[model samples]
Target: MTQKQDGDPKSLSAEEAKAEFLALQERLRAADIAYHQEDAPVISDAEYDADKRRYAALVAAFPELEKDATQLNSVGAPAASGFGKVSHAVPMLSLGNAFEDEDVADFARSIRKYLGLSVQDPLAFTAEPKIDGLSLSLRYEDGVLVQAATRGDGSVGENVTENARTIADIPEQIAGAPRILEVRGEVYMSHDAFAALNQRQQERGGKVFANPRNAAAGSLRQLDAEITRSRPLQFFAYSWGELSEPLADAQIEAINRLRSLGFSTNPLTRLCSSLEEMIDHYRSIEAQRATLGYDIDGVVYKVNDLSLQGRLGFRSTTPRWAIAHKFPAELAWTRLEAIDIQVGRTGALSPVARLAPVTVGGVVVSNATLHNEDYIAGRDSKGAEIRGGKDIRVGDWVQIYRAGDVIPKVADVDLSKRPESAEPYSFPHVCPECQSPAIREEGDAVRRCSGGLICPAQAIEKLKHFVSRGAFDIEGLGNKQVEQFYADEWIREPGDIFTLRERFGSGLQQLKNREGWGEKSAANLFDAIDEKRTVPFAKFIFALGIRHVGEVAGKDLALHYGEWSALTSALDAARAAALAHRAADEAEDAERIAAEAEGRRARISETRAAAIKACGVPNEAQAAWDDLVGTDGVGPILALSLSDALANPEERAAIDRLADHLNIVPPDAPAAESPVSGKTVVFTGTLEQMTRAEAKARAEALGAKVSGSVSKKTDILVAGPGAGSKATKAAELGIKVLDEAGWLELIG
Candidate 1:
């Protein structure tokens, strides 16, 4: 009869466990749908697994509380509606996870207890890399591949036979396979392939995939076979589903048989006779993961002996003979020294958790993303209460972890270690950099400064971005130089960069006489700036640092508008649209205010009239706004942000001044003679010989319009490794798909 602590599932009472159990079920179900159906993961794998583990722990602690439809018994969500339904011969069960070495030891001990084996008895286990990919089952009849299905909801799956047939690694005809065999494997994209596919996706104005696993899943489940053919998908056979005959006596032998039958198997698979050896092998695999060309989140250890495995048979959803040893989350506990708000180029006031120096996965981490105000207020992106509704405060002990080894995030807070003197952190209503009012729009997690380019922080950041490697990339004009110039008011904006030689070259306080600047170095800097004065349309668009406009988006905008004036006009129109929307909203508010008070009616009416006047847009302007919104990859959210930035008179004037200083070249139309020329082209996945920027530049030079996404409008899709949703969509649209070599040949 232990009483439950607020957030501790371990200390939960029976009643508390029941409530938490129901909540977890709903949360997990939503997560499953988001991951399996939409291919958009709302939470990290570590967070998802933690939730599942907590539910299991609660159920284990109170066995009677377990329900029939518990999340633990499920594999994945049901098959998406479009695909043909497939009934799995054997349920594709998920493995129980082991997050620690002790968990691995417990798994071995549990097996020993179930089998009633002596401690001294040798328990051989086969350890293999746990590929982060889509689980696929290939059914063969008389050594010929007959059907293939995805592991949807364990028992029922989506039939992807035609799509599976296109995968080169999946044999159409096995030479020595059993009469009826169901080879279970993972359909995955290599790291290089995934990169190339993303690159192609960006180039074509297609949806960029989140990770290799998502890419593989999205690719393999394509409705069109041709799309699957274009994707760089590979499979690794690890287990069997239903077999007419026993392939081998042991797991290692069975894997060898699969390899012999022309199936790709993980080369890191090893047999371990002891727990120590098994754990050691897992460590070895973990160490090689970065260099493995594919993504592996963890390692799987299964009993080698088929007899022993059968003896320790099935649990509700997992096999007792096997356990997935997950790589330990790169987490560290540290005191939150302070919470600082950093204004981005887009004017997003991002909260950063300044932590006491702590090591996470061997890297010294002193800062972690608070994400937004909601996160700081102990709420999720959806505004749902998190961490038992405990807001993070300065001087609190918090757990930080790196998600995918890229972004450091605050995982959990140790409430017991929170300082008594610490008060709840109050996020500022104004931008710290420029004292501008920071407003959080409805449904937006981030609170952004509305100052636009007028904010010193935003302006300086835009200047930094303008001079960045992917933009102007002027030599001798690095971040330090940009910062120094901005601080000294020598270069307050991007336009100033182009006029620096004229303004500062012969001045009393010349750049040559400044600290760290010799006459030759200053001359070289000026020369570099001069060289970049005549910038490409794409580069110029990107240098503007518009909100939500990344390199790909900039390229898309450039391709769509063609000329600087056209692009600027479209942006202005979009800005006018936004202004009109805001005016209408204000007028409505004024009407309400006038109704509330008679004295304020005249003032309110005057304001409303002004707002309505601002809202007025001509047919041409409306059409420009329509074009801006309709552009591929430039959705409403991005369009709104871009419009707002450009609508600000100060920002628009700054951009116009910058444009005047630079000779902005219009985008070249695709070459008429080239096969891919004039085609709306998309590049997905990784390129071997050149970077994505170089490929995009080359494609643009050849007169191809590089888009960020795929649509019916896309004429050609240049697919590389890890081509996911876009490639599939292209096939559905009957768009032409080409590999890197094909693209090169066509361009030549």
Candidate 2:
């Protein structure tokens, strides 16, 4: 058997592993959302990959965590906020990964099965090098380039038409093209250009990028087209998005057509009609990878025939006909030198490890992101030290690894050779940069600075989140614009975004006269701002950018409270209940302390009603807390977060001011005619006709609330065969119980 690494997940009990798994999941979710939606990546790619592996290891130890959640569920954010956001006619998507030859074979077999063909049946394919650069889409209407966009979250992208025009490989106009054509491609910088540019930048005392891909992306997204023009960037088209008519019957033909229309296409793209041929092409591409002059991470294989690709269809996030076969990662050993904290655009204080330089997978690395203080300590979610209590520390030998990413990842700590002088690294209690108190809320993996607007790092991030696509989603106000406005002091907070027109509408500081702003663009931005004056309740709630309150939680809160007035009322009650709960805890603590001093016994246990009466907490407030906690998809943690946010005077006032800027529309009312509308449902035991998941979905679609447990509020209990205590409890409460058939009949 192969020996396992030092960070043995087996050290933890199943419960501890699960808890850590969930906490890691949440932390990654925030980082991913920032990357995909906010145009801000809090963690490096290496750290993201490492955490994903860790998440998978925990699930492997306990498969139940898979049902709990996926490590990173989706590539596209629900809404993407970036510069001049344009919705893609056809979404740019990620491809399923393939590392082993068996995975590739399985991919071919699955495609055949879906197409009702035998495994031996001839299925033509196209293999192309997967460019390690930013994805770009160039739109042409009537043979002229109209718009260019970068793949932001697949659903929407940032408009970069003027910047794209600076690239020599991108054609301004293509003769004899489709009436409406969208050419999808990669924008990259050659190794020579990257080296030369970095040298020139270093000489000029300007910013220098880490890699060619980073340089390419930075150059392309520049607000000033002159800067982009000065950068040597190239475009290579290998796919098409929206089209007025099909370019060709086959994928290869379409690629050739694009090449003929003056767009650069990958010369290495080849047609491989069989599985063996596809593998051969992959090998051929891998052999010449170093000499290619540009970086390519893997080879992508897709069905050659356009018709077959259409028939193969797409999953929610990826295409069934296409897969990216990646290269293997390399591993090496290194030493941990020091631990440092880096604050992200948000207030998240992420711990980073300074490592003794080591080469892994042909890349040299000095630092690796530790993710959070817990990761640095090798602690579980409950603060229990795992990994056999041998945490990562300075002067310890560590193992680092990487695939094709720029940064290397810390894989395992070598406590066997740890220095005797090494002590437990104490995570900072305050923000290192801002000197603000760093608060690690219960169940949160990372600690955050509580400085809010006073913290410069967080002030802009909050504004960015406020206007993010999932939030207010104001078009034309992306990262660069937000940063510029923040630096110029044109906008200081979320409310200032709404007052742009009022401040600069027709004055001497008219937006139209600004360096890059034309009359049309300025008016468009103001119009976009005005258009979002009335936002949906869920979006408005999400715009507040409260901690632990993501898009999903916002919707839950919106659905539960329905209206802002109702939500405020609930918050008030929940806050009162929280105060009462705190008082009761103090009383219990005082009783214990006094009893110890006097050497007398003190009564601690009390009935719920009795405690509420003793603490002078209103029964209505307690009931409100209970109701908020019981809301579908919401629990105590989320409820407490909402309550705490409203309790803070500064946050409350900011939220109120933002609310005043927009009309907060309540959630859509459920259908009043459905038999189970507005009723709470509980499902128990083995369902026959439908899975438990299906039943819950159907109930929800019909306006019925499906709860996990039965309570006094439960109106109906759908008990299947082998029903248990839930059914018994339902009967005791005089609640209506139904079989699977009865449930179906009632809904019908």
Candidate 3:
């Protein structure tokens, strides 16, 4: 019988303790399932793991918990009979874990020692983040997702077909036929999405998820396919289960094949030529972990050579070919003395958690990001603080730690550690820079200064966003260049970009006479600028730099609005609509009681309607906007940003000036009767004829806008092999879905 720990009730019998342990196991397992399989976590990973470890300890202390029902050795129950069980075409396995650098080096030594290779012998590996999420086996016959199963019991698992289809990162079909492929990988959530989801959950009074891994698992396990569809779950393939015929000689080659097939493989994956290089890769990942926006426990080192992996294959549960070098979890307790608001590059007032220094993962932590006042204050009925700690009052002890070591956040406050003389913090009601009233836009979490077109911080960020890849994608103008220009007073706003030639003309001529900026390079730059001038409506929209707008959104906006002139006019109106929309939607009929109801409602409704309508492209002018949005893979946030950029009067004038400076001709329209002229095409499935990215670019060259998803009005769906639900949906909606050959024929 499992014995209870010191905190257990003294009256409890031995059998009762065993029963409680078993009950705890079941409860925790259910929570894990909710986390790993469902993409909705009921508890935090820390809480779940802690409970699991406690249960394990109890079992160890009292042998009663070791009975068949409570033991950890039970194979992951029986495979759910939803799909026929197929023996792993190639066995899906786990990796051995190492908590520190020494452990990682030890793993490397073992690999070398086991293979009887000398210290000088070449040993290569492909290192990727050991993502914390559910593991699955994806089976493909000739490059299509035929079946996918959970990594239940290392043997068989529930067949989650309908749910898996919702994941955007998973490929339904692969390019170039590879007889069979059984890929293994972790499904996870991006940090941005995870935070957004948690926020939504908290707003709705639902149990908040602790981390992305748990959220991903819980989302994936949702019995309702529609529920799964709503979650933001992404999958990254790290290895394969089986291959009837090997596609690559090395692990790197195999991964390249996967990337070519439209799967979003980790770009950071590297081929370490030696053990030292492998260690270098691990260190690099560790440094970058916090910035990656995904959680990784450690780096997974694999034997790159396929032949070597085969020779080193198979342990009962894990493979000898790969090992996991886990970085220690970054968690620490710090005394929170106060919270301060800092102005962001965008004029956003960000709440910073100030704390007494503490150490975690060898880094001293004094300040962590609270993201916004709303986050620190906690939403209440009247936008007041609900947690009694408004704006993180001074002298409160705060817990500080890095989530995945990428985001430093204040997890909690230790009221007991707070000083008796401490006072509640008062949040600033005015902008720290321009003294403008800082207004929290309806439905927005961050408060911002309304000094648009004037705020230096906002201007700089806008300009930066303008030249960003997601925006105008201006070459030769990166962050450093933007900052230099801003400091030198060469540019103030996004519109100032067009004035670059004027400011640089004399200087550029001198530079041309100097070493590097010769005629060729200068000419190349001018040519690049000219090329950008006749920008696609979509790209122009993305360059606008709007809050809550991103590249994809920009395309949607451009596709919706069509012309620069129309988009600007619409966005001007949309800005008004946005305020009204939020005021109306923030809560029930409370819109009536909103202090600034009339002003807010009128402004927001106008802005939002324009923005939404801009996104939808409801008419011919809109269709012109939609044409830009239709550019394959454009998203909503980008679309909004693009709309805002073009809408700005200063930016428009700058474009006009740039247009005059270059005397550049607009892009020539496609020839009449051309197959792709002015058409909207969305590509899906496995594209064997060409790389998916290449195909989209080619389509753009032919004047056909490529869209990401199938819509009722889509002119065509470029259906490659393994065309699944999208193709079927297209057929149902009467949209044409073309295979690779069909597409080639059309373009020809």
Q: Which stretches of candidate 3 lie above 4 Å from their native place?
A: 1-245, 248-330, 337-340, 378-391, 469-481, 504-537, 556-748
TM-score of 2: 0.67
Number of the top TM-score candidate? 2
Candidate 2 wrongly placed segments (more than 4 Å): 1-18, 33-83, 102-124, 272-280, 330-335, 342-349, 355-366, 378-390, 395-399, 403-407, 412-421, 428-539, 551-650, 661-748
**Per-residue C-alpha lDDT of model 2 across residues 1-748, encoded as one tens digit per residue:** 0011226777754435644675666666666675555434554454555566577677687754553343334464644333587889999987777767888999998888667778668889899998978889999999999999988768778898999999999989889999999999999988889889999999999997767777888888888999999999999998989999999999999999999999899999999978899899999999998899888888999999898787666764678889988766667899899988876545788777888887664455787766667667776555655555567888889887665544555667787798999998899999887899999754356688988778867878778777766677788887778988888898888888888898885642567777888888888899999999998998887778775566666777798789998988887977777766555545655665567689987665553335657767677888888788766556544566678778888878887887888898998876686899999999999887755655776687677878889999999999989999999999999999999999999999
Residue 521 of model 3, lDDT score: 68
lDDT tens digits, residue span 635-720, model 3: 32233444555556875676555434432222334465569877889988887755675577667657786777888668999888
Model 1, poorest ten-residue lDDT window?
A: 1-10
lDDT of all predictions, in order shown?
A: 0.77, 0.77, 0.62
Say which prediction, candidate 2 or candidate 3, comes out ahead on TM-score.
2
Winner on TM-score between 1 and 3 is 1
**Candidate 1 Cα misplacement greater than 4 A, ranges:** 1-328, 403-407, 506-509, 572-618, 672-748
For this target, which candidate reaches the highest lDDT against the unseen true structure? 2
| TM-scores for candidates 1 onward, in order | 0.49, 0.67, 0.44
What's the lDDT of the predicted structure labeled candidate 2?
0.77
